[model samples]
Target: MADQDPPKKPSSGLRPIERLNSEERLSRLTPATATATHHEYCSKFARDFLDAHFYYCSSKFVVARGGKVKALDEAFREAESWFSKALDWIAATEKIEIPLFYESREVQVSHSFAGRLLRLLMQYDRIFAETLYSLNCGSITADSRETTTVIAAKRIKSIQQLCIPDTDKFAPDGTLLNSSRSQTHGHA
Candidate 1:
């Protein structure tokens, strides 16, 4: 029998959600980037994260999660463009030991960097939801944003159960620059 190169396997079987997550994690690893020079790579995380949320929001909910909505699709596309531009204003390795999900994947789940990251993700979800909701007339109907709204709450709740204790005083400083509140407030 001919040896047909033993059916190749995927190098990585990361899910869409996981990919989105990985991008966000990668984005955070950098301390500062002189505004990232404004690029698609910069918006990668925001685009991916919100895209996943959009998929979750679709009432067409299918296969793995849900289908995409036209209005939201455009909205998100434009949103990413705006986000990329925003990156112009402000702004990882695989095997060499970079904390992808769980801070070296060795820490306890409750203490992992992931919980802190998820907290930031939850914050993003909220801002996006609120922004979209307001722009669309205070209407978060079941057909558009129901699942995302519902699922994220549940997901956050589950993750928070492990996070609550440590989360009390452990904030990630998502910008990675570790900007102090005064620095952020100074601009405002």
Candidate 2:
């Protein structure tokens, strides 16, 4: 028999601990473009989290225990907090002014550095939605009265088609008469 070659082991460079520490320190340093980066990260995370959560709650949680439900709820809450903080960070960095209108009085609301950074993240979400629509990516239902009416009409037609007449008891002339033909035809 031929000697089989040893299976190649996947390499994790010798000093992983040192590499990890360096990477951690690099992430901690606030970059000159930190606001843009933070916004992008937060927005992407929020979008992914929302999509996953929707799928899980809609189909995966039907028979979940209380503990599982609680865990998922906590995770969702955390995601929301992250999203809010990202938005705050973006707003703060950009200094985008939001004018508040109350009782016909215009009030200028100033954003902090964090808020500006977070707002940049939101741009990704807007772009995501636009891309999905432009690509005709998923099932998009119309929320219109006309669509509802059409659906209702079809349902009514289906129900009418399903109804069976008692042919055994009623004659074509509308008389309550028992006949062998009526029994066979199911028109009573």
Worst 10 residues of 2 by lDDT: 102-111
Model 1 over residues 29-116: C-alpha lDDT tens digits? 4324212211121223334543443222211111111111222233334444543442232211011122222111111111123333
Q: List the residue pairs that clash in candidate 1.
A: none
| Model 2 lDDT, full chain set | 0.33
lDDT of prediction 1 = 0.32
* Whole-model lDDT values for every prediction: 0.32, 0.33
lDDT of 2 by residue, 69-139 (tens): 44434434444455455334333331222332211111111212223222322433533333334234333
